[model samples]
Target chain A: MPKRRKCLPCLSGLALLAGALLVAPVSAAPKRVMSLNLCTDQLAMTLAGPDQLVSVSFLAREPGLSMLHEEARSYPANHGLAEEVFLENPDLVVTGTYSLHNTTALLKRLGFHVEEFSFAQTLETIPGEVRRMGALIGQEKRAQAIADDFTRELETIAAGQCGKDPTMIAYDQNGIASGRGTLADSVMQAAGFANLAADMGVIGVAPFPLEQVIAAHPDVISIGAPQKAPTLGEFVTRHPAIGALPDTRIGAFVPEASLSCGIPSVIEAVRALAALRTEIAPCHGNAAQ
Target chain B: MKLCMSLILLVFVLFVVSLLVGPAELRVEDSIAGLFAGGSEAAAIIMREIRLPRALLGLAIGMSLGLSGAVLQGFLRNPLAEPGVIGVSSMAALGAVLVFYSGLAGSSLYALPAGALIGALLAILVLLAIAARQGSTLTLILAGVALSSLAGALTALVLNLSPNPFASYEIIFWLLGSLKDRSMEHVALALPLMAAGWFLIALSARAIDALSLGEEAASSLGISMSLTRFLIVAGVALCVGAATAVTGTIGFIGLVIPHLIRPLTNRMPSSLLLPAGLGGAALLLAADIAARIVLPAGELNVGVLTALIGAPFFLWLVVRARREML
Candidate 1:
């Protein structure tokens, strides 16, 4: 009984020491950060300084989706799974709203700070999200600068195409569409084309009927492609109806990075759309002529 | 038996309730008046255009699956055998995907159902050929596993290859199954095929019962196993394939309903068929209602909810059955 009593204080002291060690690391900010979501990875790479970003989601390297694929290639890539995130001992982790909830919960429980970006449907909110992300990662100045550059680019693109009544459709994989209140909608509007999908009142990621597309008869069709394999040009050829649409111009808006992520990508997409309109000028001239 | 009847009644009540409720709620009197007198425009549109068709389609799909599942279980003498377990549902999904993504359905309204039925028929043919040669349920199951996996992989490959983002999303959601946004046109297309398939299966219930007494005994009783098998495959393919073509792959209803109702019918395959059909319709309707009401903001797929509930129940059943056998 006397020996047992003595062991109690020893065990208590050991537990206290272990608790202090666990608490010590959490108080200091994470030095090496990894982003597991495509959207967050874009922001992290953009604002967190190159050396601080240890890894990014593999999707960040896709040239079709990300505007920064070339820059993203320098960093290691993770597949957005929790196991992959843990291997790098990331001080800060970023994920998306649609990301696996259980995995995010598990990481938070393990004393890791995870910043989750919910699906931002509108363009107005994207700039705020960028600022929030900047504050989280200690890169508020870089974030604000990028945000300003994005708004300026958007205004320039919008100014150039102000008078044109260009009806546009964003043909994505599986006949799915970005309706009103989507980033794609802002991109379309910024590029000086009225989105046919917005007119149809599509709000989220839902399958739009092919019949609706056929009926809309948009002036230009922009097909979103994956970063790798079967480019938008190939996609257009595969669907004969899209290719054969009367007086319609087809274009590919490949941002190759942050283009689809938020505000910066939206600006990039607008520029791409403007370039597409210029390239298709002859087609429009021939139709009018 | 009494409990089964009450449950069936409850499902019927639920089906009626589903018919009456929607995104736009109407009073019971207005809905009833619309049903009979063709009165209020909103009421008529809701009753005739939306709810009636959805409810009926739900009923037909439920019955077809229930009947087909019961028949397959009885024939195989294994409760574990489901339509999906034997490659029918995946093949049906593949067929629907082919028609949907290939723009064949874009050309003609009939193309979707016809293409799906063809795909299902081809799969059934393959299953029949394998089952015949092996003459063992274990071998048949292995063949089914291979066929289902191949079909699923092929469907995924097709979706991936397709440039249409909506087509890919549709492939995922369709395989999961739902009845939302389904119109009267879908009902019109699926009903005739479902009716024909149901008739074929209903005709074979007695034959299925005869086969339970051993192949030789059934043969002596003037039932040809080959003919019976052909009829069942064709019937199941037509009904299930058509239903799936319209609604995507809805799992568990056919598998679960028969098992639930079998005991009430004294384990007689023939006796169990009709009740099983009723039970299936009720279960699907209830599930659909729950799906709508549970998350009013977001429409949940009926197949997903059923699978979520059914998978755990099925696991429990397997454990219980194993314990009894031991």
Candidate 2:
């Protein structure tokens, strides 16, 4: 009887230890996180809370591609140089696998806890990505809540999309357009528009003939926001040919740089374009706002 | 004059060819209707906006190179003295690079011609000073070679330093030229300056003919040396600068066209000017047509085509010169 009494105390102590280990994530989260990719910078910035993220990639400051460029200024920026990353001595590092292979590989060899995200971003990837990043930054519960809200909102927008699918092409710098398997293509599909470039057998960024674009005459021509700097390539976008398409609505329909990567911020682009599509080609009179 | 007239006709045909040929493959009827009748908006947009500017730029830029070639050869009295050979085009490219890539002009198209003119003017003044100090053909050519290399290097440096990531890719635009999608704005920017250059070159015609008799003999014939030099220098700078600002340094058009057509003309540098300009226009228009036709989708740089034709011809000239010297 005495032995059984002693066994109960020991068993309860073991259970208490296991419970403490289960809760370790909140206590054991890295204090300083560094993002070496622009896309990761967006996710980490949203989830890392104040004073948690130590630095972002230098590209985070660029207004053309970074959504949180202003917020990124408060943190130090890395140039993807190994020496710099090592010097920062971050508890964890994040980057994209598509680029900076050498730096990432080198950091891995030096025993740094590095995480790499793929560049093949799509609308479906954002919610899960937000949750994954949240777990990495020790904000899992907050991440799950944010992720669920995002999914609910995305579903709400998708539900409103009618059978009327307007064709659109994302004409970017130098007459290039996003084809199938691109973030822009995925965004187009989600926003109730068909990607004409992808339909034309374009698999990635490829030059589309001006004549082809004119002849096809999609309902909307989505374009990148013009950089303040001038280039001969920009001439393709501002061509009088594109402007003269009377029936087509052409503009920066997507928010600036939102479609650059697949992330929660891309929801802004999706929502804007969904609303515009509804305006230009309504499913029915009832669909009109 | 008859030869000049024929060259102009050829230039016209090539200009039309440049308009008709592109990735789009517009039918002849649609193209003509688009050009004049505005019957189809798509065709009209292509004809008026895309092709018109390219054709116009080809014509104007071609004329500038040919005219400058004739003038530089005559003024220097050196058979090898085309704009690229004497560093004017490359220097002007350097100038455009400085202003355009530096974002000094705030990425405005106007900055290209403005910077190019200044660069051309400086290059011409320096070359003229060198020629004045030593009229020997070898010294001037050697000096030109040095300046061109230096300018070329600096242009690459400036482009690499640009804030835009895409700016580095545009080094090809500076080194070898292309006029793929030149807009009317390009035409508006360069045509006036080129026209002014032609007028100045025309004024110095009689003086150049006299100088062919040798500098002293020409001067004794009541030709004011300083005035003639000024006209030719200013004229060449303005035309070549404006042309290069838009098209990049298109080599050999200035060099090969004049030499090829000079024999057919009266052989007097003054008499060769008009034919050379016409010939230059035809050659560039043809090359631009070929640039599109040859690759179709991956359009060959017009400068590359011109260089291909010009480089061999340049070699032949060098060989012939060496033999004559021996």
Candidate 3:
């Protein structure tokens, strides 16, 4: 029986190698693509041709975490398990540097073509990342167009900002504020608001004391949209102290999941913040100059 | 009398200190003005909405734990009996986690106490049944250990099961407890229920004092056994349940406070209650303050601080207990 099992695999291996040799000449780009990270899933969905993206990580469908969650429903989801990716047997896999290090390593050892996007993304890197994903999926022309549009739109917004930069903080659940070296910080800076948490020497996401928030009195406190399920942490964002800050615009300024990643759609966050900055402190003098 | 006065003074001082200490570094005069005279809207909100609730919860939850611990010890004649030690707090935490995270009651804060009360009621009933059966002190403690472990496991399981990714992070908060961001809403929801529980527990003070002279001796003095049991069980369920509902299971405060304060009193169960409660408030407030100071930005859990102090004291008691048994 062991001899028969060995012979069976040998026969199938020969057949698979023959099949690959026959199919390799037909196409230069991978036909089947799987994304093992949420950020990668959105990128793949945007750039991959019809039927090219076989599956995306399950987080891609989470409305609170994914900007393209509506479109994600069309694709099947993977839980980023090496077993799932192996079972599907995609030609190329894309993931992020943030999580699933073990799965990525395992898939690489199995001889799968894996592409990784760094988790440390900023507005400046979005165009490059978009272009890279496009090239990987053989949609470089379309990717270049989108990247140029993003850069042009961002420059227009930056031109509209006055020298008077209002202070803002991306305060999320549990009093966590987005600080320096984060995507939110870049977006806030581009939208003409000084990142208060970052200026206070906070690095990345950390607990910004409600007391400090009241003391600093930033012109805007951008909170995350409330999740479907309740958490005690959510209550911190709705703290009365935040509500009581004089002349501060406290609300969900950025659309849900817009600022969570450095996608092309992050322009929505910048646009929204820039418009808000124009409304609160107009750039008439800057325009004249 | 002096002990009672000193404890009250201690609690008051700690409450003031808890209010004053924070990451904001507000001056004393500004904080006072903010709390009272409405000086800057920002300062007023910080004082009234932020620090006030945290300080208030510390005092109330601490008082509830200490008072319950003293009452349970006196009624059961078991020095080791406490809400956290006896599994009631853990069960209450489990109940809160189940109801709140499961989305059964939506996103309302009311779900916490409602579920916790049910969990605490079941725990107290079970413990009461065992006590009624004349279970040994060791049996009660062992049962408590089993219940606590089971509830802790279930609490973790429920948190992990929640669809919200952030819910898993809350397992530590529910298990270890924190008073970091409590507001007046929490205080309002819990204070009245806790006060009612205190009143019921206070009503049984005389009965517990009588029970300490042995059950038969207490019955001879006209203390109804059934009435006393009902009061303690209901009171404990309300106090511990509501407290755990808001802050999770703050271990060792209920266990340690009564023991420490007992020495300051005349050794009578009824007399030990008030001072123990005051001492509990002082201890909890001090621990909460230390939690902020220890790691200013990402504060330590208040339960961690209490466990640090109480775990050692609990071991000392166990050793003494073993020596006495020998």
Candidate 4:
């Protein structure tokens, strides 16, 4: 009973320390966090707890490309202007290093706590990104959980691949195609398909000649879903030439916005595409047939 | 007749050069084979689908600009009365922008011609109304400047409102013009309308020549003023509209060619038409070839070259017109 009695003060003292630890950093947990880039918006939204994220880039509100568009509406939006960043007075700012080099430089000059996510991120880097964002927002445990789940789910999807390795090309608007070193190329590989555009010596995104696309004769062509408004660039996707190809599965296979960036939601893209991969060119021949 | 034939020859030579020059260096034999006999499939697509359509469009659109310019100069009785000058091409660009970007006609190529034709017709009507009433050189030129800026502004607005980022980028193409990567589909869309324009302009040939001798004198010589006006308006609208629909607004071909080749002709409006048309083709083809060769990869917009050549020519025209008026 005396030993049991000592446990109370020890537990109370420990509780006091735990309370101090939680409240002290919780108070420091940036009152206003802002995202200046699309990819960072995805990471910040997923990792940050409720009300922790103050605003996201205006592009996040666009349904065509944003995975968490509904969640994005609750928060205010920023146009990635340095003045807006200063006005909002965000303790921490997140953005990609692709564009707005001047804004990033200016923000650094003004002594803002800025974290830059690289643009050339592949599937392998996504889990780390989730964890890193979690750490930034003082929600390390939640981020670790998301990172583990993302990694595990990715593995599960990767494990399901039968290695039939059907060829696919990420054909986009205006006859552009994603080649090697692009996220699409990595996604195709992870889903047990070869990127035909990459195989033909195309590096990064480039103009894919319609004739070459026909000549390569890929098994699948992944096109981005067209937006609500029309564009002549979409004609290449629906051209009679592309339609003429036999035994080809052409579509926005992984659903819109899934493969647009390297987010945890991209696991769904992989899962959906992995399912498609099995159906099209299954290792267990009789089962697929 | 000999000058006409030689001008035609120059156009033909430039046409061949246009086909020959591209980012893809097909051997002459391969290019000829691709154009005629379908040598290698790659060469064939490059020549036929990519370069052939571009070259053919160059020939046809160049002819249309020349023809329109010639006809406008003759009908309006003003040297500065080209489609781009008086806002016909700019209005047509606005029409094409409104229809294509608004998706009212869907993603069809026909939308371009449909919208552009309407725009050109409206511009012609407005200009004709102005010309028929006052018809002073200064008045007509000022009206044209106003129309061009208005149409240009509206075209820019439409493109800016367009959800497609690429559509906004196309503002440069509309204002400046280019013939790069034009397909046979575009050739199909524009050529027939332009040919009809040529025929209609040809029908008004004798009338324009007669009308050039002051409106009263020409009309007294058995010319129906209303019918002549209609033909000129419709003809210029069709040619310029169809041309702008495909190639965007290529300026100064009409202005410079007529003035240059008029000296070669007997100075009659009717006589100047054929030579002006041929010279326009030659100038446009040469410029387009230079456009391709200049950058090699990101080919210069042919309109940029035409403007570079045309803008200086235009300033000179202004100075000379002032001197002659004085």
Q: Highest lDDT among the candidates is held by which one?
A: 3
Q: Tell me which residue pairs clash in candidate 2.
A: none
Q: Compared with the true structure, what per-residue lDDT tens digits does model 1 show for residues A1-289? A: 9999999999999999777645543455457887888788777777776488889888788765667787789998888777887777788888888877888999988877777898774566777888877777677787788778777776766555533557888776645677787878877776667888788777755655443454466788776543232221233223544554567776566454333667456665667777776665433433543
Q: DockQ of every model listed?
A: 0.04, 0.34, 0.57, 0.21
Question: Who is ahead in TM-score, 2 or 3?
Answer: 3
Badly placed stretches (over 4 Å) of model 3 are: A1-27, A284-288
Q: Residue-wise lDDT of candidate 1 within B1-326, one digit each (tens)?
A: 67667867876797788887665556799888866787664466556656777788888888888877888788767676677677788888888777666665453446668877888888878877767444565666688789888888888878777654434555566567888656667788899998999898888888989988977899999998888987888888888888888777788777788888887777878888878888878888888888878874546888898788777776786787678778
**Order by DockQ, highest first:** 3, 2, 4, 1
Each candidate structure's TM-score, on Cα atoms with residue i matched to residue i, is: 0.58, 0.91, 0.94, 0.84
Please name the candidate that would achieve the greatest DockQ relative to the true structure. Answer: 3
Looking at candidate 3, what is the lDDT of residue B266?
A: 89
Candidate 2 RMSD to the correct structure? 7.3
Question: Residue A205's C-alpha lDDT in candidate 2?
Answer: 82
Give every candidate's TM-score on chain A: 0.77, 0.88, 0.89, 0.86
Scored by Cα lDDT, where does model 2 land? 0.86
DockQ of candidate 4? Answer: 0.21
Predicted complex 2: DockQ: 0.34
Question: Residue A48's C-alpha lDDT in candidate 2?
Answer: 88
